[model samples]
Structure formats: C-alpha cells, structure tokens
Target: MNTRQLLCALTVCSTLASTAALAGNAPLQQVQKKWAECQYSTPDGDEKEQCFQHAITRIGSYLDKEPGNPELTVWLAINKASLAGAQGGLGALSLAEEAKSLLEGVIETSPQTLDGSAYTSLGSLYYKVPGWPISFGDDDKAEEMLKKALEINPAGIDPNYFYGDFLAEEGRDKEAKVYLTRAMQASPRPDRPLADKGRKRDIEATLGKLK
Candidate 1:
C-alpha cells in the first residue's frame, strides 16, 4: 500500500485500540497520546487526509454502536473536520457542516463540562475553512470557538495560537499580542515548536503593521 493507505490503516487500528482500551479501564490520556503520535507521523495533505478519514470511520462506528457515547461522538466530528482541506469541494463542505453539528450538540448537551477537544476541533475547522462572507471563515465564530476552548483548558496552546492568528488578521494587534504570548508559553510539547514560533511571527508581524 501507498503512504496514504498505510497511514489510514494505522489510523484505523489506533482508533480501535484507543476505544477498546478506553472501555477496558486504560487511561484516556495514554490512548490519546498514541492517537496523537499516529496523527503526527502522517505527513500533511493526502496522508493526513486518509488518517482523518479512518478516524471518522472508527469513531463514527463507535458513536453509532455505543449509545450515549458523548465523548466518541465529539471525537468523530473532530476528525471529520480534520480532512476538510484534503477532501475539498462540496463533499468537504458537507463534512465540515457535519462536524460542526456534532460539536454543537455536544456543547448543548454537556454544557458545564463539555470536552475541550471538541472546542479546539471546531475552532480549527472554522479557522481553516474559506468561503464568502455569510458562508464560512467567520472570524467572529472562530474567535468564539478558540476562546471557549481556552476557557475550558487554560493550558491549551492550539486555541491560543490560532486565535492569535485570527486576531492579527483582523487588525487587532494589541489584543492579539496577549494570545500569541500565551500560545508561546502554552506549547503542548517540545516536538511541536512551530506553533509557538508561528504565533510569535504573527505577533511581530502585527506589531510591524500597526507601527
């Protein structure tokens, strides 16, 4: 099999392993760490696309087979959105909407203690998707989603970094500074240093533009 197919297969196996382990009393974080490793192992573009697709199938199956599995539903939606850029066209748009709906449902149903991953995933989807004024790429929605994610998990670097970019793009340099600074400080792991560096670049660029 090609790289994409291999990554997809690995993604499916990891997802199944994670869910089964979750069901058997293993720590959720440990399972998630392995999932993150699989995600990072795949290169961007097609390989990543296949990984997300496999994630959809595995997580979606869990959601359907296991009634009242709120967390799995959130994960399914989260991964569905992950393939947006690779999928492209109308199909991508539909998948994005599907992800958004599931995330919204999770927020509505789990209110006080919804999963932080859902918020970050939704933030990512809105932040990346491009469209006309009323359709997609809503800075307002992106801001709300990222902010909600950060509120849920103060140490989350992704939300802060992305929000910083959004604010910088919207000409909110001063405000963006705070988030970018926080993002640099909230780096989730040493291996993923670009997130912090990219946000720092945005911060500097925004400052330059403002000056």
Candidate 2:
C-alpha cells in the first residue's frame, strides 16, 4: 500500500478504537452516577432501600446487554449488596449470598479487576453475613480474603475499613483502631464522594467506640 493510504487507514483505526473506548466508559460512568445519586443523596433507611432496589433495576438493564462484562457484574453485585445492607435482617440474607456469588465469579474472571474490589467486597461479606447453618460467614475466610485485599490495595479506604471492622468483631480492638485510623487517612477519591463520606463516618463511629 502507498504511504498516504497506510496513514489514512491507521487514522481510521485509531478513531474507531478511541470511539469504542468512550462508548465503553459511558455506560459504566452512567452506572456509577446512578449509584452515587441513589446511595449518597437519598435519606431515610426505607427510602434508601427503595432507591437501591431501583438501582438494581437500572443496573440490571445494562447487564441485559452486557451480562458477561466484569464491570457490569461487579456493579450489579454491589447494588444488590447495598439493597440488602439497607434492608438488613433475615430478608437480606439471600441477597447477600447473591452478591457473594457474583463477586466470586468476578474473582474467577478477573481477581484484580477494579483494583481488587471483588476480593475486598467478598471479604466484607464473609464477616457481615451470618454464619453456620444459616449463612456463609466465616471469620477465618474473612481474614484471609481481607488480607489479600490489603495486599492488592493497601491504601484503599474500603479494604482498610472493613478489615478494621472485622478485627473489632473478633475483639481485636487495638488492631482494629490502627486500620480504622488508616482508613481515615487513606487518599481521597474525587469521583467517590458519597462512598468516601459514608466510609469516613463508619471509621469515626467505630473509632469513637474504641476510645
């Protein structure tokens, strides 16, 4: 091929690649915005639960188109988990398990995807859910997974906070305080104002009890 023709072909390919990248980003961005709005702006426990329920519906629409996309799967799991957390009690057990399964799938597909969020999330669930014949909670597994998460994202707020919370549950308040303090000092995420603020509150509330 002529040099000019080759250059034109390269430019076209580049443009298409860039366009596809933007197209991919748009849906995830929209999903994130939806989550932030629903989780951050909404007040009242019942209302938040309702909002998350709606969030699952909104995210589920995306999954309909890209069911196997790891990004979409993680977000769907997150949305369901949030709904369950807001609901609380026995009714949320099934939802939590569903989140656990989705996260496990994400780990299989891409363990380090989203900065190892799948591992962090799964670890949090292990501690939060009820154990024994009732649910999947296991302190040993929780610690193992949380430590793995820390290895991947040591400076991340969520992993530190959850690990600290788990320690507190196990009566390791001193160790828990260290991690919680670290969680407070973790670098900020500009795009995650709601999650950061909420997590900070969790850290402070936990720390307050330790003191």
Candidate 3:
C-alpha cells in the first residue's frame, strides 16, 4: 500500500453516527465535524493529530460530566480511535485499547446502539492493530464483528468499506470488489460530506488495486 492506501487502512476508525435519526448532542456533533476535517480536508499530519487530540479532550470533558452518557461515550471512543489512527505504532496501541473499552461501554448501553457502530469500529480495530504479544489484533474476531455490523447496517458505507478492504488485503479480490462496489452504492450521509468523499476515494483506490 502507498500513502493514501496507508491512510485509509489506518483510518478505519472512520465516521460513526448516532443510532437514531435525531440530531446528536452539540458536543458529539462538534467532534464529528472536527473528525471529518482531520480525516479528509486537513492535509498536515501534525495538524490533523492536533485536531483529533482536541476532539479527544473536548469529548472527554463531556464524558466526564455525563459519566455513562452513551452518546458521549461512543464519540469519545471514536475520537480516541481517530487519535490511534493518526499516531500509529506502539503509542497507537494504547489509544486503540482505550477506544475498545469505551466502545464496549457503549454497546453495554444498548447492543444495537449507533446501528452497531461500536461493533463495526471495534472490529476494524482488531484487524488493523498489530497482532500477538504486540497487540490484540485477531482476523477471526474482525470478520465476526464486521458481519454483525453488516447485519445491523446492511447498507452502511463504513462497514462495507472496511470489510472490503480486509478482503482485498487477504487477496479475496473478487469478494472484496463485491463489497467495495456495494460501499460505493451505499447511501451518503448529508451531514458528512468530507467523510463520504474521503471514503469514496478509498473505495475507488481499493477497487483499482483489485483490478
């Protein structure tokens, strides 16, 4: 994988939305907006990391106040995962671990919460992180959780993209192309223009690689 593909692979901690059609709390919305800018529009790695850290801090405060607020907790996990993606290596392992914990908490709040996004993201983390004594990456678990995510969100863009990317890396090119094409066909989130655009780039790149 080259630079963009590398970025896409790391950023599997991509956008996560609320379970309901209703608007999320203000803090969650702010974090999502900043996350998008860092993930896509912002070009500087340091700047993007800074943005993600800021979101981590900001969302952390909300989580502190609310304690068990499921919405805030999920976004906190997402931001932390974003930080992990930005930082990479051993330092990223710590951040991803925290993300996993927070995501689990969110799932406990409700299994189907965030349209099973906790499962989707946690699944992505398992596959993306380094394996063994180094970290807890597990391909079997990744597939299981990702398939669960698809059951919850069959038409969701992120789950399809990550699953397809995983299959491509595993050299399951035909099956990977099927999911990537489905991802391209998935509905766009009007609230997340930059995320949608960036993911499309990833989907397209992965498709080109398979061909």
Report the number of the highest-lDDT candidate.
2
Residue 108 deviation, candidate 2, in Å?
A: 1.1
> Candidate 3 residues 1-211, lDDT tens each?
8999988866663433333433546666777788888788876678888988888888778778788877677778888888788877697888999999988777777768778888888888889888899998999988988898899999999989989998898789999998999999999888778889999999999999995
- Pairs with steric clashes in candidate 1: none
Task: List candidate 2 stretches off by more than 4 Å.
Answer: 1-23
Give the per-residue lDDT of model 1 (tens digit) for 11-113: 9999999778667633233334434543555677777787777766666555566765667676667566656655677668878888888877877777333
Q: How accurate is candidate 3 locally (lDDT)?
A: 0.84
User: What overall lDDT, based on C-alpha atoms, would model 2 receive against the true structure?
Assistant: 0.87
Taking the tens digit of each residue's C-alpha lDDT, what string does model 2 give over 113-141? 77788888888889888999999999899
Q: Considering TM-score, which of the candidate structures 1 and 3 is the better prediction for this target?
A: 3
The number of clashing residue pairs in model 1 is: 0
Each candidate's lDDT (Cα)?
0.66, 0.87, 0.84
Reference-based lDDT, residue 99, model 1: 82
